[model samples]
Target: MSLQPIDSTQRIQSLDVIRGFSLLGIFIVNMIAFHSPMYYYDPYSWWGDSINRPVYWWIDVFVQASFYPIFAMMFGAGLAIQYMRAEEKKAHFTSFASRRLAILLGIGLIHAFLIWSGDILITYAVAGFILIWMLKLSGKMLLILGFIIYFLPQSLLSGIMFFASMVDPTTVTYFSSVQDIESSVANYGSGSFADIFGQRVDDWTYANSPAGFISIIIAILPLMMIGAGVAKTKLFEKASDKKLLLSLSALIFLGLGIAIKTSPYWGEKNLAFVFTQDYVGGPLVAMGYMTLLLLIMTAPLSAKLLQPLAKTGRMALTNYLLQSIIGTIIFYNYGFGLYGEVTLMTGTLIALGIFVMQVIFSELWLSKFKQGPAERLWRKLSYSKK
Candidate 1:
């Protein structure tokens, strides 16, 4: 079947709203690296200063590792949505999805190598390719697989670290060396564009290694599958029907997630605990957030208030790249050279300001155009000659 574009009227407001909300959280977390060297971001060691410690702790407990899963799950939901649309039109799913992901991979490469090393687009694109095959799984199987894929690697690593640390008290290291930290700061903060570009290349290289690649796939792909399961179940579309189940899930998952995530504060920040907090608790909290958003969207009072966020979500691809562009310009040496100069609080405030502007821009832009600029480009490329 021929591919057709989804009209604005056909868009789901809740997905857009939740996606926009996730962007704010993502920026809040990413601002740390944008303004400083992330190689040594240990709160207990690098940020020993008491004043900023609390801020960092709050961000870690509430913001970090929470929203990425939400974004990933939403991506899966998007694939499922596209699949459903394709089925409705009697089109081939794999062909369209493969081309779409190919274009996304190109965009991700440009962003990762040229713009920022911390880009998640490459992971998303790679995971998207894998997600196409798992779309046929039942919701129960998808959820089970999501948990298994996400936790198995972390669990094994955590077990090894725990056992090793028990055998050798000094086996566990919490933060990077001071020399590495200083070098990172120098390269990112004051180095020439070439120097910074070289550093970015190194960072990307480390992140794209076989081990790193597998780790990311295991972490991300399962969430995407769960998201596909959510789409298949029509959970969001039929929110009212599953209100009780969603409410209970929100309570249980968020409670357990918060408990696991906060365990680091009570003890040492070892590899085992870190893995559990991020790999396990993170996705749980993200699901809780999703269900909570769905519940909120059911309320009539929230619809008007959420419209701007929905607009932002509708143009997420454009805004995501824009964040990288604007953030790098603000913090990199080639631009304002504010790297390593701003505190976490200041960085967060800046992120919030940028997000506000983006929301306004999104609302205005959507009024005139059918899709965000980048979204339009992606769709154009994906549907070309279809």
Candidate 2:
């Protein structure tokens, strides 16, 4: 029999910190998307456009490019860790991972149906099955595959954008309306906090179908696979390695991301349609942000920020769903009904406040409990009460 490696149960502090941090960071970007219509983009109402702007912009820049990638990278790391644990225990990986993924799917379904349409768990669950296969490949192979998958969608999107730019330079499929955008945001924001009954069926269908939510999974699988590769290599375990790579990631991915965001040519429309989609530059930049966190994790000072984040990470599923619930209560017409009314600046503050509260809540919650509420439930279900 092959020798099992070191203790698999040991928790990695850096991973937890990065996870928790990403939880906070993701909301900065997700809030804009969440509060508005799914299709339209309006700066004034979406993120804020006025004198209180610098703060919003600061949040936008810092949080927009930072969190999602870290989450994705951690997903990869988590997958690798699970695989290692399975191997160490001489268990069936596919069966075990599939069970976990299925539970995640169920949780995601509840989130999308009852909470928010912008939920990401379903995508993670779907892509997870495919990611398991890539786990055994070499790091070099996985990295190459990651880039290939990452750009494949972008390649198709770029082709479409190029043709559109040439054929109908005036045509814009995204961000063309303010009123429609408001209507869309209002539709969700104006309803009862949990009154997604009418929309839930449609949203759930869209979320599960290939052209909708599933596309997101296809688009992101590459990054997740790359994350698994990184975990396999023990890259996160070495501070020096993370520092060097993080610097490179900043220069390459972050530089490109900033340039893309600022360029007049890209605009909000392209940013949403061309850049943020499956076949766009957004995920590429996410990769860079992942590196940034690794570098941050290497610094001992980072422990403060990362510790809470790690706790959040440890209970990511619960926290993610909780975000939707919290957002619903605060913004929905049936609840606090702030909706399209909150200024970008105000929303940003609220988001930060909620994040801080969650950190405290999560830390306290975890201290008394072995696993997150949702995580524990998931394990219980997966184990079939064995």
Candidate 3:
């Protein structure tokens, strides 16, 4: 097996740190689903009390759609790195990449069905297949196409929603079936393991139905392209070379992201506005967060402070799966049976607590080994058994 480099003092990449940071935000947002049937309920309408309402509002504006983009970009960049390594080694890119993604798909399948339904690994693995073909595109071309492909559909959809809201907002579907929430609570909160599995299938289907998936593709694929482009261009270094410019750009993106993301609250709070918030605003915020983090990490003291995240990020896939495992065990009937019982605040606390443990776990794990357990398994499976 490949080992961690012989030199132990090499600086970790900022990308890994960002990946680790994204996990906390992802878990925080996912905590909503872990504790409640958030998919079936209208977030705008739920969280009735004083405590939950503000909690939801904070998450929606800052954390909800924001961090996933960072994660997606990281995934894309990491794949680009792998592609580069393959090219350097004169390896057959196609067969190798396919096998790797296939392994990911298998892992995702187990995670989605056996553990939890809110799985992005499956989607990423599938997207990796598409990205493999697109890797030949130049960084500039990738960026151009990524922006166009992503924004064109997203803009059109947002426009349609906005116009529809203006016409009659009630027709827009924010929440799914009333029965969905009830069944989810019954199965996940109190029923047997089999019951939770059944509900997992339903939840996965509800989110990934053909029509719904088109939206996911446009959102995910373009970001992947942009991320790959960034990696290919080495843009992070160039952009970061000038702290003043990077800071200004980061502020602008953050300001704009906040403004656009809050449209649902400030202007309409309707389905159309919600779409804009998730699709458009989320990426902007992600860019801002990334730049800002890059800047912070470039500084000596702050970088040292945040180094634990790099350790966690190096083991990101493992931590992500572990999160699902922990979350399921905490919420599912076969485990703690706390589903539908924990509040938003409580779930946030749980996420924070878990992530802290993961940071420590990652540090400890990496000290003695090269990769996290899952990542080691993935690498081993992707290559020769010998």
Candidate 4:
């Protein structure tokens, strides 16, 4: 079906507010991924001796499981909203949405290759492409599929770890070896600026190559679909209406985040060394953040503060790229050349500092500018003159 442009002025503030908060969430999580290893664990033991550092430990505990889920939920919300706009205009859906997704994919590829290796935009674009089809599914069905796709991988991985702990202590030991950890850290530390950039280019090329980034992105389709379903139903419309759901999600997220973080069962001997070394705590905190932010948006008193976040959310792509450019210069060898030297706690401070600046800047920028620079271009590119 042909899809139409959504009303520019008729946006729901809750979305922009949630999105603004989500941009911060993305930054918090991406900061860790930006500074540390590609995977959850640190290849180099830069932070190993300091893992017991209180600030570092706390950050890891709260942020690990948080951001991506929030982003996932937001993605779903957007899909629902977009589909609604299309329906409202009585336009066909597939072509326009596909064009948008394709642009996103292109942007993501550039982000992955030219800027950050840990870019989620590509993953989101890929997921969005598939999620559009589920717009016709009943909300309940969409919700069910969302949880199933989202949880299956975690459940399976956890099960494997549980069984391994019981049956193969030696194998787990090998996986957790100090020797392996040390070697990994050393490799990362030794890489030249050129080498790191080369690795990023390679990753982007592979992800966008004929092998297709879409399939890999499929892994997150369920989460995005659920998010879209949530959007369609106006789940965030009135947080008061869904107080129970919000509270429960907050509790579940907090409980799981704490459990996974503090569990000695997963313990110090495991990948906590890896996960804690980066700013792993941002995502955990981001969930708590979203819950609180959504609740706050429902309050009349906080509308002023909510406005900036909504503005930032409106220009999330521009802000996201800004974060990477700023972060890379501050941390990488090509710029400040302080990649391995900065502590996790300090890196997080830097992220928060930059974030506050962006919030203030975004608020001011949007006051005069109609859209983010990139957002304006995107709108121009995505639409034809009617």
Candidate 5:
């Protein structure tokens, strides 16, 4: 049973389109951290002036915690596709996937330490190693397991924190002091390259600490498993057949997601609310987005209009790294040194401008190359017979 090698021609347009779509949302979210010290605490307290407060509020409700789940799901779906192909070809799936993830981990390390402290690739690559073992589970089991893994730790942690906060209000503080905020502004906004690099190292260490690593693994592995389940069920492939289910899912998930995610604004941004919004509402909304896109892809006119997004999705790796490079240069001390200077609205506009440029660049690049440069390198290294 020999399977044909997957080529660009065999690529699924909807998957690419969704990936591309997620890129824009991700950039919008990441830009907040890129240009400010928002990653250290709630930006609303320190940086959200009156003019940009509403913008920050809207992004918190609608954009934050949404796109990353979609990206994780797609990654799982991709791995499942690879497994199926390997099975058909009787190839060494585990060995090949291990090699692939290892190379990805190497790339992530450089990206994380040298380029950006907020890198997600390292987490993805590490979680992917565990995902390979769970690829054999049934879709139903995978979904159940994914939900359990996603909710359990966060729920427990949030519950404990909530109770502690009730007993001791000081326990729940997430915002840095004004002094710390001012120091961050000085260090990142006007400091030299060495100063910025030191801060980046410290940030990376905290984010990739033992507990942080464990939490990321718990959160991400399930999404990958659910993605594998989606591929196995061919949910996207038979979209019309599952119209009723998809439609219902979209309505229910989107409605509930909006409700849960916006609850923080109405009340305090407590640990419980944050967990629910990120772990539960985030994935639900991401599912709704996936279903909505699938429905839209069925229409010829809509699909044609979305071709640019598909092209962008195909080059996701290149664009992702490009975003990090361009973002740091633009906002960090090394380049324009605009950190903590841009407002939320201005940052949002910058993200949109970058995305538009990326879309055009993606189309032009894909016209001349079968794969993005990074993607080509990844494949070559993964398959090299060293």
Candidate 6:
């Protein structure tokens, strides 16, 4: 007997729905970087106008750091699912996983360099390789390990920054330089493709600095572990029997997430508060969202309503890359040259427009095909006997 991929009947509708939902948030956040000098400017002051500030605040509290954690967790869940399938079939999990991640790395490199500087796929793929090694641990242990690894470094850094801010508030707000910002505006807005490529490298380098590995590990790996842990406990299989538990967990998580996320606003947008808000509160909100979506999915009516989103989620990778492609065309010099020109509100609206178009497109495309083109290619390469 040989291993085979899971069919549509075995797929989780709720998971798909959640994944589809996160794509919107991720695009919304990415749009800010796509059309602006996001890397060089301190966001708080850059979007400080009365009009943009409220838009920025809405993004900060509800959208910014909130969605990616959910996606990272889901990525781990996906790995765990494949691992369990491999084990069930007595196949070689490690080799298959390695090849799979390698392909993802290749795709990520192209996206990060040739397409967009703000790509998360490269980081995710690299961290996934690390996660594949630690899959042998028990689920509860994985969860505990994830919590400790994430909390310790994040809290310590937040504390250190808070202390430094006490000495001088500017210490935490000095990531910008006039030349970098001006250069970004120029290159992305009106330069040739070669010029834009040069700027893309600079932007990617700044975001993925070599020294930030530990930070990236804590940021990405922990959520992934927690997700794998959840999968091990068979939460998806057994969640149906625990609707009440899910309900309570959703409320508590959402409440705490919201309260903590408001730290920058109610407490003050100091480095400490900002760190706490993004690093600590963001994941909490992501958890809340996952649970809440799961709970809603339990309802027959709600599940039916969210079926379209599930389709979107099923084609996640295709849509993600498409977002970058479309975003660049709309804003980059090669397209409309609207880069570094749109307001926050306008950029956000564009993101929404893109998502809406994707939803319609996914629905139409999946009506006949089993998956997105990118997913088909990934599966073909991974499962091909060649």
Best by TM-score: 6
Residue 330 miss distance in model 4 (angstroms)? 2.0
TM-score computed on alpha carbons, candidate 2: 0.85
Give one digit per residue, the lDDT tens place, for model 2 in 105-154.
Answer: 88887887777767778788888988988788876687788878777666
Clashes of each: 0, 7, 0, 24, 0, 0
lDDT of 3 by residue, 41-119 (tens): 8887778688888888889999989999999988888787677667776767788778889999999999989998999
Question: Which pairs of residues clash in candidate 1, taking residues 3 or more apart in a chain or in different chains?
Answer: none
Q: Which residues of candidate 5, in runs, are more than 4 Å off? A: 1-5, 177-183
Which residue pairs collide, candidate 6?
none
lDDT (0 to 1) per candidate: 0.85, 0.69, 0.85, 0.66, 0.83, 0.88
Clashing pairs in 2: 16-310, 17-306, 17-310, 20-309, 21-309, 153-279, 154-279
lDDT by residue (tens digit), candidate 1, 90-135: 8889988999999999999999888888889889999999999888
Once model 1 is optimally superposed onto the true structure by TM-score, how far is the C-alpha of residue 58 displaced, in angstroms?
0.9
Shift of residue 86 alpha carbon in model 4, Å: 0.5
Candidate 4 lDDT tens digits, 1-386 = 44435554877787787777777756776776566653434322334465525654554455544666677778778777877877777876777778887888888777777677767777887778778877988667887887676556545655576566678665444233445334323433455766666756654554456545543465467767767766766777768787777777777756655665565325545433233312123334445567777767777878676787788787777898899988877666566656556667777788889998988888888888878887777767776666
Off by over 4 Å in 4: 1-4, 38-46, 50-52, 173-194, 202-219, 264-289
Q: For model 6, what is the alpha-carbon lDDT of residue 281?
A: 88
Residues 198-289 of candidate 5 have per-residue lDDT tens digits of 87887787677898788788888988888888887788688877778878888988998888788777767766567677777787888888
As a whole number from 0 to 100, the lDDT of residue 90 in candidate 4 is 82
Task: State every prediction's TM-score relative to the real structure.
Answer: 0.96, 0.85, 0.95, 0.83, 0.94, 0.97
The positional error of residue 47 in candidate 3, measured at the CA in angstroms, is 0.8
- Rank the models by TM-score, top first: 6, 1, 3, 5, 2, 4
Task: Judge candidate 3 at residue 360 and give its lDDT.
Answer: 98
lDDT of 6 by residue, 220-316 (tens): 9999998888887777767777799899999998899899999888876666788889998899899999888888888889999999999999999
Candidate 6 or 1, higher TM-score: 6
